[model samples]
Target chain A: MTRKILRNVGVPILSFVLLLLVWQWVVVGFHVASYIAPRPRQAFLAVTQNWSALWPLILGTIRETVYGFFVGAALGLGLGVIMAKVPVLQRIVYPVLVLSQAVPIIALAAPLVLILGFSVTPKVVIVAWIVFFPVTVNVLDGLTHVDKDLLNLARVYGASRWRTFIHIEIPATATPLFSGLKIGATYAVTGAIIGELAASDGASLALYQEHANANLNTAAVYGTTMVMTAIGITWFLLVVGVEVFATPWQRRTVARRWRRR
Target chain B: MTLLELRDVAKTFGDTIALSPTSLAIAEGSFVAIVGPSGCGKSTMFNVIAGLLTPDGGDVLVKGERVNGTTGHVGYMLQKDLLVPWRTVEDNITMAKRLTGRVSAADREEARAVARQYGLGDFLRHYPTALSGGMRQRVAFMRTLVTHQTLLLLDEPFGALDAQTRLEMQQWLLQVWRDTGRTVLFITHDVDESIFLSDRVIVMSPRPGRVVADFANPLPRPRTVDTLIEPAFIDLKTKVMRLLHREDA
Candidate 1:
């Protein structure tokens, strides 16, 4: 077991280290200027040197992203279930949602910041907006496209509408719902940063990036970008972890299906 | 007592008639099988009886109570096992009671006992995806039986199984039917299966389906695979085949 886990963990780490070494070698060997394309060592140095200043920015961005993720996820799941169960509501609301999706949430961020007074609310709301569509669409697809046989069984067995929704529809849609949540988690970070970019008084990663670029500290800008990527990847992994814990049955089901195939 | 009775049940979709007005009766504890070709409206009849769809004409009576355009009176197993993949065997088995808000400790205990009786005690916590096809059908059967409803409707329940598994399921179904004494209305296209498992076999005509013939299976009780070779079984098979062939011609 230990050896297997080592092989699983070791290969990715080794490959990543090799790529970084190659990147470092290429930058140093070619004498690339830092201002144009920051060297790997310089980017790493920028992060270390700016740690004290960047710490608060990272925390602020993370707070907004986390809040946005939960709010957006909750709204998405609730709306998805409602729209799936109530077709009349779906008919009234679906087209509007589709239209809203076409209008980029980033474009509305500045207006939202202006209206909401540049607080975390705009960022969180923007993040929620960004995430809400995919989550809702995935959930809708999963619920609507369920195995017809299962629905027939529910009908024949006297399952009430609510009962059917809880037992049949909800469980069936869980994997897809989690898939939406994972996508939403990654977008939450981007949404928060964009909102911060629109207007922010306090420290945020977006503010740092803007300041870094203004000072022509390209390495610092790269460092800020790296931090944001880290945050997004971390949040995504958290969502995946929760999904694994929540639906252990899905793994078993998939494995069983493969075995049969 | 007549557990279920259909009177002049006729259904149409748009301009296409699925079933012609027809009447049938099932006693309180007898096993009846319906045999027909593809598109003969055997499924339509089951849907009407199970209350998934209401017939355009006539009434569906369950225990003499007119139940039309409604569902959930009888236990129904579809052409496939239709077990919810996410739910455990025990949970699936107890779902009928759960849906009606009638599930209790006793009901759950009974479900467990029934699972054990059906040789699924070891798999009570296992999901449908983990079970073999035959095991999954057994789970479906336990689920249907646990409803404790006197009337059961099985729509080609073993039609998806291999020949060997299908034979075993037929024997298992017979034992279960005999033990429970529940009224069963089963649908199938297999003449041998219909004769082996049913007390009476009702054959329907094509398209705007109507009952062409109803034969009381003359095979003796406590039948087994050996019974398949019996002269009486062959004679009944020939008779049913002749009717089905005549309709095809």
Candidate 2:
């Protein structure tokens, strides 16, 4: 099992290096002008050289993303648990939650920016909007979709509702909750970027983005995008690592599912 | 003394009645097993007895007092070892005592002593996910024990185990039951299990269910799994099997 996990970690990293190697080759081979798409190495170099200069913008975006992620996740998970337990809440608010996720948050960005002004508020709101539905829906499904026999067993022990939540409901729903958090983390980065793009008139990166687009500083754009993707991937992998550590119960289930693949 | 009585207990899902006004009494200290073919009301009876559902017609009594919903006297274990994956075996067992009442240091020591006596002494700190299937079941059993409830309702507790594990568990359970001396009402479709464990076995008919047969196990006390091959065990098994075939007929 340790070998399997080590193999999984090593193989993916090597494969990613191979992929980038090919990417660098293809970009250089086709004489793809820097104006069109920057070389992978150049983009890396640009990001590295500008790393210190980029800190304030990166930190600013991370702050927006994190604030949004927490607010959204807490609300979503809380409402999800409520809806799962209470039919009236399910009837009233579930459809609204469904609708809330339907309208692409990208479509909502400009107006959100206008209303919330060119401030951190719009960005945080956008991130929260992006992170909410998946956490709520997945968690609610996990909490309510418990096995019938297990429910009966709890009842027989005369487990209090609170006790059942701690012992059965929450634990049973762990896989889905972890999945929700992982997905929420990925969207958090995008949500923050969207907030920046939409409300960037006075922001540090905003000024750079306006000038960069005209000069076709595509390397810079790709650098920002690559950095954001790295952040998102880091967030996702952190969640995945936590899931593996906390829910050893899922290791077998995940292995079995992976085996079928 | 009658500890629990079900009077006219009937549960229906839409037009289909699962339990039909079934009435039964469980005496204190009696280990009774309810047995029947699949789709019978054995599980329904256990649920009613456990107070998980509201019977359309009847009332459930715990210790001769009418109880409408889930109560504390009954400790239930099910087919699956529902130990929380994140909890240590000791944590799982200790959960039943957490919020109840203040205990002397001696009582906590006694709880640990009991767990150690039950073959789980070494595994207190280990998480449920670390244990094997059988060990997990033992932890589940120990958890039920921590509550110190008088009545135990086991719903096919060993049904999910392999046949070998299943037989071993039946014998192990007998020892535990004899040790604890809790009133046990176990539900299963396994005729042999019903015969092997209980002083009396109640057999029920299939859906739209009713108890069609009840047999008393005349086996000797301190029974071993080896006794299952004895003539008296064969005779008891034959009787339950006959009632089971009657359900098919």
Candidate 3:
């Protein structure tokens, strides 16, 4: 078990340390100006020194991201199921959905804030807008493309529409649903930051980063960026953990395939 | 007792005739095998009886009730095990019950009992991916059996197995059929398999498929692999082969 944990956790940490060393070497050797690009240690120190001041802003951004992600995920799943059930709705809505993704979320963020006011609501709306497309598209694909044999099996046994949906459709679509959720998780962080940058009355990570940039506090800016990245990574891992819990059978299948190799 | 009757049932897809006006009567608790070449409308016939496809003409009667274009009258298995990869063996077995209505504790107990009775007790919690091909097929069979339907339509259930496993599965299937006393209509192109497992062998002609000949097996019950070489089995096989070839000519 310890060996397994080392393989999973140790390798990544070792690689991260190597990366930090490289960053340090590049900064010191080039005699880079600290104001232009802070050393990794400087960035780390900046965040730790101002941890008390920055903690609330980080928490606020996280809260907005969580709210937006859940809202978007729920809306995407519900819409995908609806579209799958009714092909006519899919025909009308799918093109619009794709086209909507073409319009940049950044373009909509300012107006969304202007209309919704400088509250968490606008930020959540922006995150939700960014997160919904992948979730809906993936879920719809999963639902529409369920194995025909399984569907026939359900029908042969006289499963009702609702029962079939519960038993066959849901299980079949779960993997794809998780795929969308993972993508949405990363996008959700970006959405929160965009919304915060557009308008936020309270302090947020984006606002903090903007202030640090204006003051030429490069170390603080780098520190804030690192925090944002950490949040994105944490959300992604959380989704992956949920996926593993939900789909135990998939893990076994994957293990079997690996053993075969 | 006639459990299922198909009278002058015909089907067409666009301009192509898939099945002719074919008629068949399946007795209660009889094991019947249908052998035919590819595209011989065996699947179309199975679909019609399973109520997945409505016959263009005539009627399909189950227990004296005309059931056409309606489903849920019989248990059906396919060449592929079609076991849901995500479900455990026990869950897969009880899937039919879960689908049709609520699965009570009694239903789960019965499923466990069936699995245990069939030597699958150890695999109740195991997913389909963990099972061997033969075991997966057994699970598929158990799933169909748990549906509690009197008639089962198995379309080449062992077609995907290796030769050795297929032989073992054939015997296993025969034992299960005898133990359950359920009427089984098995579809396969393997003439030897049709003679070995079934009480009756049905030979079907090429597309626009019609029953060329229906021969009752003279072999006794609890037949073994050695029965494949029995004179009666050979004679019946030869006759079925002749009819199939005659249709080709």
Candidate 4:
């Protein structure tokens, strides 16, 4: 058990520390100005010293990300089910979904903020817009690709259409749904950050980063970025945790494969 | 009593004639096996009987009722266990019941009892991924049995197992068949298996499949590994093989 933990947790920490060391060495060895590039130690110091001021902005961005993620996930799942069930709708809306992704989120966010005014609504919309595409596409793929033999078995057993969808189709789609959610989780933070950068009268981590950049406080800028990165990682880990809980069979399958090898 | 009767059933997929006017009847509480070459419409016939495919002509009568393009008359099993990977062994076993309607406490009890009887009690809550191929097939069989259908159409249920596991599963299946006494229409390519497990062995002709020969096995009840070498079993197997070879010719 301890060995498993060491492999799981220790290895990533070790690699991350190595990266930090490399970053610090490059900053010091190059004799880079603090205004241009701060060392790892300076970035950490900046975050720790200014944590009191940065906390609310971090919380605000996190709130935006969380709210947007749930809204996007719900919408994506609903649309995906609708599209999967109705082939005509899928043919009509699928291309539109792809096009929505192709349009730059920055451009979309600016217009959204202008229209919605300076509130969390625009940020949530931006985040949802960014998060929905992966979720929808993955869900559609998952539903469409359910094993035909299982469907046949369901039919032979006289499963109603609703029963088949709930018992067979939904469970079959869980893995792919989680796949989209994980991808969306990583994008969610970026969406919130972009939304804040576009226009935020309220205090936000992105605004803090902009202020730090304008003052040439590169260490503070890096610190804000690190917090954003942390939030992104947290969101990703959260999705993974839920996936692990929801799909215990997947882990068993992987473990069985490992045992065979 | 006749449990299932297929009268001149035909299925054609565009230019390809999958099954050409096939007729057969299965008696209640009897085990029957159909042997045919690959692409000889064994699956099409099974699908037709299972109501997955509407026959181009004739009727499928289950217990004297025509059930065309309608399902739930028979429990069907395929070569692939097709157990839902996410569901537990007990869940997989009771899947047919769950799918058909609300599973009662008695239904769950029956599933538990069946699992325990079949030596899957300890793994009731275990997922299919954790089970072996043979075990998965057993779970699939249990799933079919719990559907409460008097007739079962098993399409090469043990075809994917290794030789040793296949033999074990055959014996296990025979025991289950004897215990349950459900009418079984088993499809396989193995002549020896057909003679061993079935009361009657059916041999189908090549593509656009039709039954060319149906032989009643004279082998006694409680057949075992020793039965494989018995004169009656060998004789029946040889006759089935010759008939199959003639079709190939």
- Which residues of candidate 1, in runs, are more than 4 Å off? A1-15, A253-261
For candidate 2, write residues B1-249 as lDDT tens digits: 988888888888887778898788888889999898777877777777777777888898988888766656678888888777665666667655542434455555765787799787877666677787888888888878767888888888888888898888888888888888899999888888888889998988876888887777888888776788999999888888887897677
**In terms of TM-score, which candidate is stronger, 1 or 2?**
1
Q: Give me the runs in candidate 3 sitting further than 4 Å from their true place.
A: A253-261
Candidate 1 lDDT, B24-69, residue by residue in tens: 9888999999998988989999999888898999999998899997
Per-residue accuracy of model 3 over A151-207 as CA lDDT, tens digit each: 988998888999999899988999999999999999899999999998877688998
Model 2 misplaced stretches (Cα beyond 4 Å): A1-9, A244-261, B12-14, B98-112
Q: After best superposition, candidate 4 residue A80: deviation in angstroms?
A: 2.1
Which segments of model 4 are wrong by more than 4 Å?
Answer: A253-261
Q: For all candidates, state DockQ relative to the true structure.
A: 0.52, 0.32, 0.56, 0.55
Candidate lDDT values, in order: 0.87, 0.79, 0.90, 0.90
| Total clashing pairs in model 1 | 0
Model 3, C-alpha of A201: deviation from truth (Å): 3.4
Poorest lDDT segment (10 consecutive residues) of candidate 1 chain A: A252-261
**Model 3 over residues B1-249: C-alpha lDDT tens digits?**
999999999999997788999999999999999999987889999999998899999999999999999999999999998898887888888889888887788878888898999898988878889899999999999999988999999999999999999999999998899889999999999999999999899988866778888999989978987898889999999998888788778
Candidate 4 residue-wise lDDT at A259: 24
Over B87-124, each residue of candidate 4 has an lDDT whose tens digit, in order, gives 87877888877777877778888989999999988887
lDDT of 2 by residue, A1-261 (tens): 888978989898999899888988988899888888888888787778888888787788778878998888898799889999898989999989889888887789888977888888998898899898899989998987888766666666566777777667888888899889888998898888877877776655545555667888888777777788887888778778889877765554222222210
